[model samples]
Target: MELSEQVAIVTGGSRGIGRAVALRLARNGARVLVNYRRQVAEADKVVALIREFGGDAFAVAADVQDEYAVEAMAQACLERWGRIDLLVNNAGMSWDTPLFRMTDQHWHTVIETNLTSVFFCCRAVLGAMRARAYGRIVNVGSLAGLFGNVGQSNYAAAKAGLIGLTRSLARECALDGITVNVVAPAYIETDFVEPLPPLLRTWSIETNPMRRFGTAEEVAAAIAFFGSPAASYITGQVLAIDGGWVMP
Candidate 1:
């Protein structure tokens, strides 16, 4: 899908899925603002790579959990590009623990990072999107939230909440030509999954219908689609990039 002349903001864009999304959006003809919490070098690398391919991009550091930082990020995009046509809320983390052993900090940290940050980032961009009467908001979610993975209670709750938020936002912004959606990926081969025990990784692959870990590029494709004009009529939807794992 051609996103010619559009402007996009991809949070947590320094590495992993976020990094892939940033590159993909730039390739689709969108000028991108890659937002990172840390890993400045990695963020710059992504920007450089985009430029290498004749795509435009820049990196911005922001802790999306902070409303002020989130606001600044939005302002940076507006000042640089004059408008925001897409937002990919791809910044999130997981602190796994069974319900009985979960700590308050665990709950709060995961919720604020995964769910509340989306709220902050989305709020920061709504005004600009409304002004243009065109926008695409894509949330990177997980199958754990839909099927409830063991020891991921906090993460599941946060992502489930994201789904609810996306639906409401879709309705609220539909008339403004804005769309909101979520892409849920499972067993993706990213740095996040690289440290898992070998046995756990093996089991995940064996159990998946596709019999392999999904790639970040694969998930990035779906996010890019959701962020493009091709998906103009698709909103309030949760797309699973799990190689058939999310199907009944």
Candidate 2:
């Protein structure tokens, strides 16, 4: 689905799945704002790559968990592009720990990064989205949210929160011509998965029906579909890109 004449914001877009989603949206004809918290160099590279392919994009730094920063990012997009047609909430982090050993900081960090930021970003953009009577919001969730993971209690809880948030928001905004959906991915090939212990990595591969990890680009493709006009009528849905890892 083409996104010609659309404008999009992709959070945590400097690397991994966020990076791929940014590029895909740009390629589909949307002007992109790639949001990053730290990785300035990586953010610059993503912007440069988009420009190289004759796509419009720029990097913006914002700590998404901060409501003020999230508000500013949304305002920046509207100021530059005149409209924000799509929002891909791809910013997230995880610190694995058993429930017993999980410290308050660890719990808050994952929850704020993975869940609270989505709340901030969505609220900041909804006013504009509603005014236009058209918008697409896609949240990047995790399979752990659907089926809990060992040593990832915090992560699982936060991601699980997205399902409720997305569905409720989707219904609230459906009459406004805005759609909200979440995508759950597992065992993805990214920096997040690279550090998995050897035993865990092997087990993951063997357990996956595809016998492989999902690629960032693969996940981005699904995100792009949700962001495009083709998916206008689809909302409040969770599409799992886990290579059949979780199924009916």
Candidate 3:
């Protein structure tokens, strides 16, 4: 078990890529805290699945956008597990309005949910991690951040901010044995992409060298790697799980 006896906090762990990452980490022997904002049933299901598989897990509710809530969430985890070993900032939302039509509310919601949430969660756990001199922070980013996308200016900007955040934090924490990295996924087959216009979806698949959308599990694998000891020497990096959609 690569993560035996470790503790992990995965935001948005109720479903999709976040769910997959939580399950993977649990399978690797980490006691996981599945954090969700509203999907209590979904989060419980994930925890149950882990428990069924002989892995330790529990669900916690927190609006990652709220700094106080995030801080409390981290504190609760530390109280329950005695230490924090990994943190996955995967809670995010997307607003697809074109730049010209984007509203202040839309822009702010996306930025606060996707980008600012990372800042809050990272800060919440840094103290305990620094004290222990051990931590793994894997932020879930997006290909939109790497290559601009139509009607996704807000999402792209938020994700792009995450990349910058990861790099700077990695530099600050590297000597402390804490690694920070980003897993930028493109077109994963999740509810997040199910509402895409058919034409655009087709174009996305066609343009991708693999000619298909990647799976949530695939993206989770990358995230799990970054959250594991295997990635100890890796930091301040972005691993794109885009099925060749992003060469860089």
Candidate 4:
């Protein structure tokens, strides 16, 4: 019950790491708003699971890249819970293409989805968080942002931008009792990595000291820590949940 009576908004909460984070927060006693752009059914399933466990949660549809949609989503949270205590910017999309083959659309789509959406969602909740003098903001990033992965230039750039945003926002909100941090996971065992080519997947596992891809639940545990009061003194930091990969 670390987050008892708190309200959390988790983007991309329909599946993968986002879904795990939403469930974990709810398990800690937070009323959760599971946000998804598509996969309405998946989002509802997450909600159902939380409710079945006697936790409070509901699904809200929002394209996080759209400023208006993000605003409406924030409004919905406030209307239902009276305040927003945590915001997890976990909604992201990946486009894997070599730098030479990357088009403007490819670059923009990844940047907008992974980076711009964080801007929209963070700004949307800042007012309420500042007013309350308490907030926890955790942005989900990736190892590519830290160690530069081949064919993931757009993704790396977007996640790198997110790290910068996290640090700057942490400084700006420090006086307001709001903490901002990032969780960067590498090769997590989610649908996001299921399509990796055989050789690439082999390389992913062999290169890591742990010799395995991390699980969505493991990444969620790190996120849950950042979102909890236990981490109030921590901010402007990046924690890598990569099973010994990207050791920087």
Candidate 5:
């Protein structure tokens, strides 16, 4: 767990689970590059907090859905840190809607933001990681992708695609000492869930086997484990932090 001097990037690190992962990695001694799309202020705030905690961190703005932007983000990190040891594809976008109600724009947006972004970022870093023969990649998926939540067809499809991406990348990178995995979190009490209607929120809470929502810190720990040296042998797998909501 001594990741001192390791350079890592956590996409969507402006808030919620992404922010928590960024902070947790920093605490574990990684120089963090926090990426955000539109939340410049919030992303900067996370960077400030990381610095306050005596960790090396900085904010980088990029729309993950854009290939050029993702490539530049990776380039910036490499230029500043020399190399990247860990990559957490935590940036995602989603809006609930039934299948018939999902517009072309809706479907494409969700798929591009959630699934395509992972591909772009991972591709941008894979060459460098392969050249060095060292890397760790963790994708942040959702239980909704596994259980097929209603009114979230777009989200489910995109997240399911991420799992597939994780597996394929793991297979390709394993021989190079790169391990890729996914962390699927359910009903975390973040701003994303905080605004849900009372009944929906209550249902999500009570449905958890633990009778409560998982915390961002809990999910962060799972992400960190996959990215750490301790998990060198674990790859092409999904770890669920769902309060036992979707036990295998």
Candidate 6:
């Protein structure tokens, strides 16, 4: 729990679950790099919030899907903090459409944004972590990936692929003293889902055993757990924070 000198990079840290995770890590004494794509102001707000809570954090701009950008993001963290102790691959996007109507552009965007970005970020820090013999990686996955959902084929596929990536990287990096894991959350009440149709919103809540939408902070707590030293022995595992929505 004592991550006083750790440095963490959290992609998509501008809002929602990402913002929550960034704050949680900062609260635990990690100097956090809050990564965002286009929302500089929002990302800055996250940094402000962390500072308000007596934490060290700053916002950085980068498109996670861009390999060079991701590498640069990681480098920035290293240059500023001297080492990267944790990474949260939480940048992602989703488009709803039936399989037949899912265009090539849509499919490619989702896969690249959600899955390939994770790989690029992981690769960017792998060598450094191996050299230091220390690191923690917590990927943000989705419940749709565990149980197929209507109109989200692309998102589900990307998240499912993330699970595979988490497992593979965990095994490959364990010997180097790094841990990799995934945290799947179901329908957290955030800006993303706040505008959804009432029917859909109601259904999402009713489907959960708790009969309520999860909070961003609730999801962040689980993610932070996986990145802590206490969870050093847990790797290649999927921890669901979905309120019994998906048992797996």
Order by lDDT, highest first: 4, 2, 3, 1, 5, 6
Instruction: Name the runs in model 4 displaced over 4 angstroms.
Output: none
lDDT of 4 by residue, 1-248 (tens): 79999999999999999999999999999999999999999999999999999999999999999999999999999999899999999999899999999999999999999999999999999999998999999999998888778999999999999999999999999999999999999989889998899999999899999999999999989999999989989999999998887677
Candidate 3 local lDDT, 65-153, one digit each (tens) = 99999999999998999899999999998979988999999999999999999999999999999999999999999989888788999
Instruction: State each model's C-alpha RMSD to the native.
Output: 1.0, 0.8, 0.7, 0.6, 1.0, 1.1
**Which pairs clash in the backbone of model 1?**
none
Name model 6 segments beyond 4 Å from true: none
- TM-scores, one per candidate: 0.98, 0.98, 0.99, 0.99, 0.98, 0.97
219: Cα error in model 5, Å: 0.5
lDDT of 1 by residue, 137-215 (tens): 9999999878888899999999999999999999999999999999999988888887777998898888888999899
Q: Can you tell me which runs of candidate 3 are displaced by over 4 Å?
A: none
Model 1 vs. true fold: TM: 0.98
Task: Output the lDDT of residue 198, model 6.
Answer: 95
Residues 1-248 of candidate 2: C-alpha lDDT, one tens digit per residue: 38888999999999999999999999999999999999999999999999999999989999999999999999999899889999999999999988999999999999999999999999999999999999999999999999889999999999999999999999999999999999999988999998899999998899999999999999999999999889988999999998998783
Q: Per-residue CA lDDT of candidate 5, range 1-248, in tens? A: 47898999999999999999999999999999999999999999999999998999989999999999999999999999989999999999778888988899999999999999999999999988888899999999998877778889999999999999999989989999999999998888888886677998888778888999989999999999999989999999988888888795
Clashing pairs for model 5 are none
Better structure of 1 and 2 per lDDT = 2
Candidate 6 lDDT by residue in tens digits, 1-248:
47898999999999999999999999999999999999999999999998998888989999999999999988888888889989999999888788989999889999999999999999998877887999999999998888877888999999999999999999999988899999988888888786677998888788889999889999889988898988989999988888887687
How much does candidate 2 score in TM-score?
0.98
lDDT of each: 0.94, 0.95, 0.94, 0.96, 0.92, 0.91
> Any idea how many clashes model 5 has?
0
Clash counts for all predictions: 0, 0, 0, 0, 0, 0
